[model samples]
Target: MTVVTQEAGAPFGAAPPSGDAAIRTRGLTKRFRGGQVAVDTLDLSVPRGSVFGFLGPNGSGKTTTIRMLLGLVTPTAGDYSVLGLPQARALPKVGAVVEGPAFYPYLSGSANLARFDAADPTAPRGTAARRVADALDRVGLSAAAGKRYRNYSLGMRQRLAIAAALLGPRELLVLDEPTNGLDPQGTREVRALVKEIAAEGTTVFVSSHLLAEVEQMCTHAAIMRTGRLVAQGTIASLSAGLAARIRVETPDAAGAARVLAGLGLPDVRAGEREVTAELGGHAPEEVNAALVGEGVAVRGLAVVRPSLEDVFVGLTGEGFDVDG
Candidate 1:
């Protein structure tokens, strides 16, 4: 699918989204009280039907950027567009929540969605109802359609929020910390649902501190540090910047180093009982076979690639709770 991703100098919600580019932002900036720069000049693009993960550490401006994109907080500088609408006037088309999604405690899930339909006359009721039903089913919340919001668990409420976001037949769905309170099973379910939605040509722009989750679910990603975009690209391309790590659990570190030197792998470093270095096109199986052939008992061998969390840490010079 053609993706209409973020472009330079494009106003928020202006110009038709071409080639499946669902969301785009350029020079986006946001500042809060006390001179805290919540978001600095940042550029981003999300392709239609793409599961795009926005990754960063806490206070890295992930939430601030989402807020600006949804128009809840205006950017101090730069331009943005969502679903082909200019940010200046795209309020009617965008559906998002920067923080947690709020709902009436007394209202049932279906009733809340119906209320949304009533509020947005532009959303066709028949279409909205169908979308709501589909979303509920997708999120595994169909059984709780009649239950009040207050009775729903945290995960269920989050799913309801996702349903509400899907209610207007939106082509682009933006979520912040979507898996915040979900259990592992609920997280997997939501991740699968996100992929399914993206498969149907709807863009999914989601943010989270957990890089592992993003690595598993997202096709493309952007990394932010202290309100600035430090890295962005496909996973493979990003990994190319970091050195490949090889882990060998051997009783003889010196002997392994000598053997690796014979193999001519560059920048080999030895530590207590383990050695790491860039693998110059040699597969793990090949390395293990070579070691075993040399009478070196290879207890275990594993290749460690730079994870999305690793990328975030490399770019930010810091680390936080990355394994959500």
Candidate 2:
């Protein structure tokens, strides 16, 4: 890890924005004592105000990267700049919920938030209550502010951790598997909260294993495999090059396959009632017309677009662990 110098580091009170990338890393790497390469030489660029999904299967170094971004763990090599300046200097502008934030179980939500907010000495001396109240409200926990932390459900606890991150103005919010262990309803709630946070113009960086959720919620994404960055781009851009497939079901499936094969279609497969082939930029209209011209009546037809999960599997060769 490159040593952070006095000139490059600043306190939480550093001046307003200085860069375009909310987070940028060059050759960021980490390795434990046992020689486990959790993260390899990575170059990541998170655009400002984007709901960026950091995706990977479990143990793909998502958490380690977040830890390094939040300064919870130091990298064994490389360097990164957050919010346009050296990370140490730009932390106040960044908020994060890394792993499960440990809250005092005996304390009420409001009380716990007050304590956490108080630790940020840069914050004003007199507005603790208001800040805590606003933070809890932001995460939709206003009604449960007075409830003891121990009594909260897993979802509620997760939101509280996010509330804690919102104690003050934040330009960037990094969440690592924000919905890791929640039920479907809880997952929906957290995902909704994430959208709201992004709507407020904050750059939300979410590291999750839920491909569908990421596909639905994130504006941009970066996919990881093993310990390296595999793919990164706007969801549309990343998927734009993925070929679609055409599937048609008909009584004359075998004939249809023969026709498609004669027409130079590749990977044509004929089953009981369906003939499918890799579209490879071939138009569905072209396939449909050809089938009809060949006297094959199309019963059902579809052009299947590849999903994020498809992209993930293709890129990483692993099934996304939604629970991860």
- TM-scores of the models, in the order given: 0.83, 0.89
Writing each residue's lDDT as its tens digit, candidate 2 over 25-116 gives 77889998999999988778787888999998888899999989888889999998888776656787777888876799999999999888
The positional error of residue 33 in candidate 1, measured at the CA in angstroms, is 3.6
C-alpha positional error of residue 236 in candidate 1 after TM-score superposition, expressed in Å: 1.9
The TM-score measured for candidate 1 stands at 0.83
Query: What lDDT does candidate 1 reach at residue 88?
Result: 49
What is the number of backbone collisions in each predicted candidate, taken in the order shown? Answer: 19, 0
Winning model by TM-score: 2
- Residue 199 in model 1: shift from native, Å? 0.8
Off by over 4 Å in 1: 1-20, 88-94, 126-131, 282-297, 317-324
Which portions of model 2 show Cα errors greater than 4 Å? 1-18, 318-324
